[model samples]
Target: MRVLFTTWSSPSHLYPLVPMAWACRAAGHEVRFAGMPSAVPGIVGAGLTATAVGSDEELTGMSASGKLAAWHKQEQWPADWPEHPDRLSPAQVELLAALGRKQCVIAERMVDDLVAVVERWRPDLIVSDVSTFAGAVAGAVAGIPVVAQLWGSPGVLRYENRALGEEPLPEYAALFARFGLDAPVDPAALLDPCPPSMNLGSALPRLPMRFVPYNSAGEVPSWADDPAVRPRVCVTWGVTAAKVLGAAGLEPLRRIVTAVAGLGAEPVVAVTAAQRELLPALPDGTRVVESMPLQLLLPHCDAIVHQGGAGTALTAAAYGVPQLVVPQRPAPMLLADRLAATGAGRTLPHHVVAGDEHADKLVADALDALLTDPAHRDAAVRLAEENAAQPSPAELVPALAALAAR
Candidate 1:
C-alpha cells in the first residue's frame, strides 16, 4: 500500500505522525510525507520517504503580529472569528483575524504541492494534519481516501455548529473548493489524533473521530537510563513559548531556574539554538542542555514543568511523571484540565506566575508539592499506566491500513 501523509510542517504538528509513518513502513507499506520543506528533515529523521509539498518562505515569512495588524484595519472580517467584532479590543480582533488568514494562506499555498505529489506518486491513502486542509482536497482530487489528524481537539467539539459558530470542518471544505479541488466526503473521518476521554463527554462520530493514543515517537536516550543519576526534572516551554520567553518573556526562564535550584533535583532545560545564547547563569547543579530528546529524558525525571503543549503533557502522562503545566495557550490548557481530572497533573495559569512577579514562589511551591507529595506521584503513575494500556502502534497500523484497503 502507498500512504501519503501531510502536516503543517511545524515540529509539534509533524512529530506525532512519525510513529505511524515508521510503523507503516516497517510493516512493508510505502509511506510518503508531504508538508513544509522545513519538515522534510524531521520526516526523513523518522525514516520515511518525503515529498515536499510547500515552501517555508510562505510559512515563515509572515508574522502573527503583522497579520493581526492588517486585519484590524480591514472594514469587514471573516465571520467565523471567535470574538464578536464590536466587543474585541483592537489587539484581540487583529490577532483573531490574523490567525484565520494565516490558516487560509497555508491551505491555499499547500494545494499546489499536494496536487503535484498526488500526480507523481499516486498514493493509495492520505493522512493530513488538521491544519493542512488543502492536502485533504488534493487527496480527494487524486481520488484517494484522506484521514485528518490533530494534536489537540478543536474547540468546536464542545460547541454546536451553526451559521454563526466556528465550523472548522466545513471551513476547510469550502477553502478546498475555492482552490478547485474535490470536496472530501464525510470530512469528519479525517478528524483524529486526539486521545480518548479528553473530549469532555461529547460523543464522537463513529468512523473517523477515533481516539488514537498520542505518540511523540520519543525514545529513551542511552545516557538517561544510568542508575546513579540524581532525581530529574524536565523543564520546557515548547517551541512557541521558548521563542516568546527567549525574546519577549526571558524573565520567566530566569524565574523558573531560580525556583527549581537547590531543590535536590536536576533541571534538564530544553532550549533551541537561538535561545541557548540567552541563558542566565545557573547554579552548580542545574544542567542547560540544547534540546535533550524528551521521551529519553522523561523516564529519568521525577517530574515535568512545562508550558503545557498537548504533545509534552501527554508524553509526560504516558510516562507516569507528575506534571506541572503553566498554560501558554488555551487548547493545551483544556487538555491539562483533563489530565488533572485523571490525577495526572496540575494546571498553573499564566496569571499565576505572570511578569516574573510571583513565578519563583509559584513554581517552587508546585515542584515542592509534586516531589514530596505521594498522592500526586501515585496519580501520575496511575494515569501513565492507563495511557500505556491503550492500543499501541501495532494495533493502529492495521486500523489505518484497513482504511487504505477500503
Candidate 2:
C-alpha cells in the first residue's frame, strides 16, 4: 500500500503523524509525507520521503507579522463549554468558527498543490493531521480514503462540528467548488493517540493508538548517560510556542526553570538553536541542552515543566514523569486541564503566569509537589500503563490498510 501523510507546516502538527507513517513503512507499505516547504526539513529529518507542495511565504509572513500567534491566542473557555460543547453560547460558536476560518485559509493555500500531488502519486490512502483540512479535500478530489489523526484529546473537531454543522465552511466550500465537488468528504476513520483515560468524547468512529514520542532525530547529550544526583526536571517550550507567543512566550519557560532550580532539582532546559539565542542566561547549575529529543532526555528526568503541547504532555505521560504544565494557548490549556483531572500533573494557567507577582513561587510550589507527591507519581504511572496498553502504531497498520482496501 502507498500511504501519503499530510499536515501543515508546523512541527507540532507534523510530529504527531511521524510514528504512524513509520509504522506503515515498517509494515512494508511505501510512505511519503507532503506539506509546505517549511515542513520539508522536519519530514526529511524524521527519515521519511518528503513531498513539498505549497509555498511557505504566506505562513512565514503571518508568523513575522504576529498574525499567526494571534490566531492561536485563545482566552479561557466558559465553565460549561467543555462539558456541553453542543450547547455553546453564540460567542463560543463564533470562536470555533473563527478558528475554523483561519484553518480553512491555510488549507485553501495548499489544496491545489496537494491535489496535484495526489493526482501524480495516486496514493492508496491519505493520513492527515486532524486539523489539516487540505488533506481531506485532496483525498476527496482524488477519490482516496483519509484517516484523520488526532494530536491529543479531541477538541477542535468536536466544537467545529457542533458549531458549524457537517457542511463545509465557506472557504472549504469554495475549495470543494474549485474541483467541482459538491460538499466536503468526511474521513473514513479517526486515529486517536490520547490514552482513553484522558480522552474527551468524540462522535467520530475512533481507533485508539498509543502515543509514540517522536521529536525528530538528534545526538544524545553525553550528560544524559550520567546518573542524576538530584531530581532532574526538563523544561521546554516546544518548537513553535515561542514563535506563536512571541517574546513574551519565554517568560513562563524562564519562570519554570527558576522554580525548578529553586526546588534544588537540576533543571534541564531543552531548546532549539533559535530559541537558545533568544533566551536569557539561566540560574547557576541549570543544564541547557540543545536539539535533544524529549524521548531520549525525558526517561532520565524525574519531572517536566513545559508549555502544554500535546506531544510534550503525551511524551512526559508515556514516561510516567509528573508534569507541571504552564499552558499558553487554548488547546494546551485543555490538555493541561485533562492532565490535572487525571492527577498526573497540574496546570498553571496563562493568566496566573502573566498577572501574578508571586508566579515564580507558585511555579516553585507546583514543582515541589510534583517531585514530592507520591499520588502524582502513582497517577502518572497509571497513565503511562494506560498508554502502553493501547494498540501500537504497528498494530494499526493492517487496520488502516483494510480501510484503504475498502
Indicate which candidate wins on lDDT. 2
TM-score, every prediction:
0.82, 0.94
Instruction: Report the lDDT tens digits of candidate 1 across residue range 1-406.
Output: 8888898666888876776676778889898898777888877776678767766673544533564334212232222233233554555444554565566577677788778888888888887775566766787777787776656542322211222134444555566676565553433354444445443332334222323333334545566777736667878767765443345444465566667775777887866667677666766777766666677677778988887676787678767789887764545555666667666677676655655566677788988888888999998887666655666554677777777777
Candidate 2 ranges with C-alpha deviation above 4 Å? 60-73, 79-83, 86-89, 155-165
Candidate 1, which segments miss by more than 4 Å at Cα? 58-63, 66-98, 152-174, 179-194, 201-223, 228-230
CA lDDT for candidate 2: 0.83
lDDT of 2 by residue, 330-362 (tens): 568778888888999998876687668999889
The TM-score between candidate 2 and the true structure equals: 0.94
Report how far residue 231 has shifted in candidate 1, in Å.
3.0
Q: Cα RMSDs of all predictions? A: 5.3, 2.1
TM-score quality measure for candidate 1: 0.82
Q: Per the 3 Å backbone cut-off, how many clashing residue pairs does candidate 2 have?
A: 0
